[model samples]
Target: MTTGSVNPRRADTRRNHERILIAAAESLAGSGEVSFNAIAKHAGVGVGTVYRHFPTPEALILAVYRREVRHLVEVVPALLAEHPPEQAFRVWTTDHLAHYMMTKRGLATALRSASATGGDLPANAYEAMVGAVATLLKANVEAGTVRAELEPETVLRGLGGLLYLDSADEWRKQAAALADLLWRGMCTHRD
Candidate 1:
């Protein structure tokens, strides 16, 4: 298949792949380990179809993680377009926290298991996150809302630390407070 060419069969395959990923993520987020049959059923596809796309559960898990990470990173531009730079940063940080929390423990364990088996998650996960932060920080700096000397990696590392907190209801509240604190430190004119 050539670049930019539209093949109906390939499009259909991509749709199925996306559906399976979404279903699997939802399953992993809501509860414990989900079987391939359950994922297939949730996706409205047969078991064979799921297997054809992802030969192993590890592959499926990793794919979902990568896709979600990409989505989070890609949303920075849109967020900035809709809100002020400081507001955009806060919104993105909150959204990022929510996404991480939604992925839940089961998906996390699968990622760790896959990494242990040398099917490691992509390093670009961190890079993508830092890049998004950098993009938002740059705009904020230009707008004079954030300090010019701030480092995107510093903010990213701090927020990354929050992702390790216990996944309890109180932790969610704390995470939001921590994000707000981080925003306060980053900004020049605090509200």
Candidate 2:
């Protein structure tokens, strides 16, 4: 019974919210216009539970986008810690490309809805993404593994075309090849 202690019920509620977001993301990945009932069923929760967590589809979409962005931003440091700068950057970028491919459909729809409202959606998603990659790039530059002049935003912008690829199965293969190309272009020396 300490002040500022976590409440079990509140923790459970937060867990449920995250579960709902994950389910919604999965549902939206295939078709951007998935029904709330489908998302609720996917999450193994009642429709009322979903509504309690997200009052509107826009709210759910916004939350999903924010969560996805947060995951990308948060994983960078851990990736760098576990791998060489170049390897970490490649792995992170590859993961990002895959994530974009998986979520592109729903994310596009969500972004349009959120933007139409001019709501609390974080508009700095690119900035956050580039910043994370920049950290890895900086480390590689310092290590002489990558070019010192490479700009994180420029690299990200260059990879933007991958998002428009027509096939999901091909996305993974093409993304890997693109990552290899990027790695070669950025490296100080060819192995």
- Summed backbone clashes in each candidate are 0, 0
Query: In model 2, how large is the Cα lDDT of residue 89?
Result: 79
lDDT of 1 by residue, 1-191 (tens): 47987799999899999999999888877674658999999999999999999998888889888888888888889999999987787777766646565674558888887778778788888888789889998999999988999888898877775655554466666767878888888879868
Can you list the residue pairs that collide in candidate 1?
none
lDDT of each: 0.81, 0.80
lDDT of 2 by residue, 32-75 (tens): 76578998888888999999998988888888888888888899
Worst ten in a row by lDDT for model 2: 161-170
| Segments of candidate 2 deviating more than 4 angstroms | 3-5, 165-167
Task: Identify the candidate with maximal TM-score.
Answer: 2
RMSD of each: 3.1, 2.0
Candidate 1: lDDT of 97?
48
Candidate 2, residue 152: how far the Cα is off, in Å: 1.1
